[model samples]
Target: MSERLRLYSYWRSSAAYRVRIGLNLKGLSYETVPVHLVRDGGEQHTPQFRAANPQGLVPVLVHGSRTFRQSMAILEYLDETWPSPPLLPGVARERARVRALAQAVACEIHPLNNLRVLQHLENALGLDADARSQWVRHWIGEGFAAIEAMLAEHPSTGRFCEGDTPSLADCCLIPQVYNARRFKLDMAPYPTIERIEAECLALPAFDAARPENQPDAA
Candidate 1:
């Protein structure tokens, strides 16, 4: 085994979940360093955590002497450094398509619904619980609508987001779908997303990376 790979992760953090899924898909073993975002006014805000990630985000991957942040960056790094069981395709166009689909969830959908952002909507903007819930549902619906359209129309979509093999798209989709389900977002409109998530979850990699399966899960 390589020297212990340390991951700063929060149990319910969808970004962290994406990295965990990537690591598992590569068959790489790692140690979990739980970062409780909700406790003590957000442990990620602490100086030490901030030192690892100036942005104070969870899912920072420390391998050997190098530390990486951003879920998509970490996933791409893992795929590049360890090519076996590749999470991306060999073709340039196909790879771009896969990354775009992943970004639809990671960049476009997730940020607005992240824990810190929601906390801001409550504490900063003074949005009540119902309003916050509406905010969450609105973004999830907008993102999933695009995803559903792509999955339905894209000829590249197969059993998973891209072709039959699980790609970066599946990694991103599963976690976002999990978050959507948590908020009781209606999945009826996104049958393709639901089907893809189900297929990915059936695999050992995605199953093992589930939030509840993590050590820090409440």
Candidate 2:
């Protein structure tokens, strides 16, 4: 029998959205257990949720008896375990390049604009709404500027971030693009990024993983 897959995710969490795209691309069927991040002081802070992930973050994947945390790690695990439609390129250097592109968004951009960070900006640092929005846009713009150049100048760039097929980079990029749109960031400056996002979203797998399409979306 195949192992059961369960995803503990928040509807709007970009990290969770990345995992969802990976799973869908790999043609894996999984159950989504919604963890409302905002209602009632954030359900992710609950004892039960924390027990699943001590970090109190969403996009935790339970496959059989194994539990995986972090979206990028989960994507790697899925690609390794189910190699049919690989997420990373087969060549060593290509794989590294793809991962670096993925991390450029996952590590550098997403962290600064995460929900908790924004919440802290408002609650702890006492930044007003305009300031908070500016903060989000500033970091996204800074990170995207580099990514746009990387993609635009690189010969490896295709319909997707790497080559025509979607990779881990696309999984990370798409969600960050979604978050950018949510914050009303000007996407015209990053034409290459916008083009890649458009290509990815045109595919069924990427479309299915959208935040608004999730089971727990409001």
Candidate 3:
């Protein structure tokens, strides 16, 4: 029996974008429930959405009667369940390396520049547009600098973040790159990242999973 998969996603949300990439890579057909993050005071804050995920975040995956939160967790679940075209490598050491690379973007870089953080900067910190943009750029630059060094110096770096195939790291990295470019961060400083992103985007899965290509993209 095929498990029914449904994804609650926001078009521009990087977290949601990561899940989309994972789903596409696994060749899984899933329904996308567009959760408009910016319309009418944000749909993710609605009572119904809050019940689904108390965190009020996008990329909530409903698999059968089970619900999953967090994009990284969802990716791991899907990979374990499907097991075709695996998202992580076979070796334990390589899996840890891939996870570390993924976390470099997802955990370190993304948290600082997420929508809620930016909203807090505006509503609480009273930062204007320019200052907020600078804040985002600073954090992204700092994280990307470290990631660039990691990728440039590592022997495992190839067409993707780990080896020649796209893994969980690629799924995470591509969305962060998208968000960084949206904030007008210069890509020239990270040639290795740029090369990997180019390779990932060339695939049909990544291209189809882009924010602009989502059903609810505004």
Candidate 4:
């Protein structure tokens, strides 16, 4: 149990950023092995990294002999491995709510706006820089609009996406919020999300996990 956790991550990948927040929130120590996503046609696609993750994605976590891929799965693994400071709520229904909130961002929002999809748009689809930016803003706006309604109307929405404490939902949401702003998406419509993001960032855990704070972020 003395083994140090290791994370293969790209600095600005929001999926990777999500796992970083989860790790920090759990107070777990981990070594980050930087994988440059944009330089030299992407280090993640190289043979060495692909052996660690067949999918060639960021946030492949290694602990002892165990290797975990996919950011949400890694979060669940960490929560279960170190049960104190639970990422999901204790109650079954509450857990479901948290999972749904997390999935809305991880599943709905992220897949549409992730690096690969955007790259495909620009390379394969021949979308200009402006056109790609439009594509990003449009999808993010659509997702945030639904999320805004959910958080605004739901009684469970606290300072974070779920209760006042940062949960699985906030871990997923915070990184996406960062990415949205990077694309310059107009955030005025999602006041609830904006407030929750501010609250989450106030915590040391979330603050430490910002993409800019990552060592590879240059």
Candidate 5:
């Protein structure tokens, strides 16, 4: 807790949202440096941001003088540093399960539907609004369907994605559900996913990490 912490975040960025939830759950205090991803050709693309992260991405965490990029890495870093209320499970197999569930969303689902991809789909490929909507829905449905099976059939599943208490998977999940709803994907198909999302949001940490609650939401 001695070292100062700061997060470079965009309001609606799902990757950033995941880190926000992790920090909140750990009860750590940090500064939020809002980097507007959409204002004036994205502050993230500026030379300054690229200096912090050559990839030009948000959710960069500065712990002391060390800088960390990529949401998954940041989450693990927090969990390892704090070691309280553990973002990951203790058992080896359970930890693997938690990470697998998280990757199912982070790797399989989000990459296909992130902002840059959507923008390229519309602006570069000239997809119409309806086509874009279809694109979002298709990818979400594909991912959610697999996640639904992972949760519903697995005995380890509980109130949250991995267990009753929130874990790394829940951090990845809530934001993706937010995106799914924004794109008007029907929720009826993924009852388990909806139920887990509700449980996670009921906690103050997850609620505060929501897109609308961030200072730079506009």
Candidate 6:
């Protein structure tokens, strides 16, 4: 039986963008239901969206009878349910390494720089625009520094984060790079990171997920 695949997405959301790239890479067709994150203090907080995802986040994938949230979780779900064009490589160690790299960006870097966090820092904590910019740059720099060192020193690194093919690590890296660029962070320090990101951006899947191409992007 053919299953229904639906993605509850926010066009400019880096997390949702990640899922879109994964779906594209796997050649899975899914309808994009845009959940406007910015309108009316974020539609994700509304009762409608909350019923779909208790976490009230976008990038919720409804497949058949199942629903999945969390960008990395959704990617893994897609890969597991449809094993062709695998996103993670063989070998348990290699998979773990790639997952670690992804989490470094998704968990450590993104949480601090997300829209809600920035808004909280400003409207709630009284941080000025300058301070907020610094906050964004600081976390992005820290995360990218670690990723840069990993790619530079680790023998596992190749054309992408792991082997020649783009893996989950690359999926996570590109969105974070996009976020960094949006904030105008200097990229010269992370040559390998920048190089891999450029390579990923050249691919159509990653290009399609870019913020500027999204419906909500201004």
Candidate no. 2 TM-score: 0.99
Candidate 6 versus truth, CA RMSD in Å, comes to 1.1
TM-score per candidate = 0.98, 0.99, 0.99, 0.98, 0.98, 0.97
How does each model score on lDDT?
0.94, 0.95, 0.95, 0.91, 0.93, 0.90
Over 1-218, each residue of candidate 5 has an lDDT whose tens digit, in order, gives: 68999999998999999999999999998899999888898898999999999988888999999999999999999999999999998899999999999999999999998878888998999998899889999999999999999999999899998778899999999999999999999999999999898889999999999999998888
The positional error of residue 115 in candidate 2, measured at the CA in angstroms, is 1.0
Estimate candidate 5's alpha-carbon lDDT, on a 0 to 1 scale: 0.93
Instruction: Itemize residue pairs with steric clashes in candidate 6.
Output: none
Pairs that collide in candidate 2 are none
The per-candidate count of clashes, in order, stands at 0, 0, 0, 0, 0, 0
Q: Against the true structure, what is every candidate's RMSD?
A: 0.9, 0.8, 0.7, 0.8, 0.8, 1.1
Query: Candidate 6 versus the native: TM-score?
Result: 0.97
Error of 3 at 60 (Å): 0.3
Reference-based lDDT, residue 170, model 5: 96
lDDT tens digits, residues 42-138, model 6?
9999998899999988889999888899999999988898877889998999999999999999999999999889999999999999999999999
Clashing pairs in 3: none
Model 5 misplacement above 4 A: none
- Per-residue alpha-carbon lDDT of model 3 for 1-218, expressed as tens digits? 29899999988999999999999999999999999888899999999999999999989999999999999999999999999899999999999999999999888999999999999999999999999999999999999999999999999899999999899999999999999999999999999999999999999999999999998888
For 31-112, candidate 4 gives per-residue lDDT tens digits of 9999999899999899999999989899899999889999999999999999879999989999998998899998888898
lDDT of 1 by residue, 118-193 (tens): 9999999999999998999999999999989988999989999999999999999999999998999999999999
